[model samples]
Target: MFHTLKQVPHSIAFPASNTVESGAAKEDQAISITYDKSVTLVRINCPRQDGHDWVIEAFTALEKCGMAFDMVSIQPGEVSFTVKSRLVDSVYRSLEKLEVYPDSVTDCVKLSVRGRSGQPLLSSMITMAETLAQCNIPLLRLVESYGLIEVLIATGYISEVRKALAKNFNC
Candidate 1:
């Protein structure tokens, strides 16, 4: 039950510059779409059944290590976060000292679509998801905040997903 963009006739036009063929080749040649291979998802579960306290403790440990993270999910007894793979060891060590053990560590890549303040967030997300789905790329996780939409996907499919997004969004 997600919103999907209805297909409009090709005659309903966008500006020449925004047309796919006109700009696709140029952009594709100029910039290569690649995923960050060094991203890892770290899942922390609090046996004490304290999601909030563990979240704070995890963030505090991350802060102490000067590592940046994206909060993935939070439940009553589990909290998952992600950090760059390079910082995993350091962050893990820091958390271990704090008595927080990661329940799982997974590798993932992030793709972000950013827009101006008034951009239609929900529509954009649906379009992006539909594009990826058409290309047979699975969206592992999704997060929307402020003016950004971040999608977590398997690293292996990132290039294909990016191409689909660019094609559909006319990026």
Candidate 2:
């Protein structure tokens, strides 16, 4: 009943590279992990409860495919009026895991600037991204410490990180 990560159902996940976190990240060194719900709003269908079920089906499919999401919303636009409901929303988890470096520790991302080539830098970035994903530290904690584009490929924070960046930079 689940979908592949690539075929992640639109119901369970909103396909966008939008902010997952609740607020903006202001620190300069914060690393963000925003996800790409990545799907576009393409078409519309007839209004019916079956549409609600369809959305739920998509979300359940996504879960089987290794993708998770929350806050399912269904909206029906009719010639008369619009109706909406939250069909399926995943509960927020506190995680409550132990600290990594703790709040007292400060980190930095020092990039070696080169004029023409970015391969070396990209390679280095990929490695670093893998490491960050493995850290097992809570993503919000990492972001509270560092900023977005600071951690491009953090697997765990992929959904929330990019959002933090846009909020802080106002871009």
Q: How high is each candidate's TM-score? A: 0.64, 0.19
Q: Check candidate 1 and list the clashing pairs.
A: none
* Candidate 2 residue lDDT tens string, 42-115: 12233345445544444344445444432222456211110111111111111111111101111211111111
Residue 25 C-alpha lDDT in model 2: 30
Candidate 1: regions farther than 4 A off: 1-35, 103-106, 116-122, 134-136, 166-171
| lDDT for each residue of candidate 1 in 8-80, tens digit (9 for 90 to 100) | 1121111123233234421112122223555777777774664377688777877887777774688677677
Error of 1 at 45 (Å): 2.1
Per-model C-alpha lDDT, please?
Answer: 0.59, 0.26
Model 2 TM-score relative to the real fold:
0.19
TM match of model 1 to true structure: 0.64
Compute the lDDT of residue 65 as modeled in candidate 2.
46
lDDT, residue 168, model 1: 65
- How many clashes (backbone N, Cα, C below 3 Å) per candidate? 0, 23
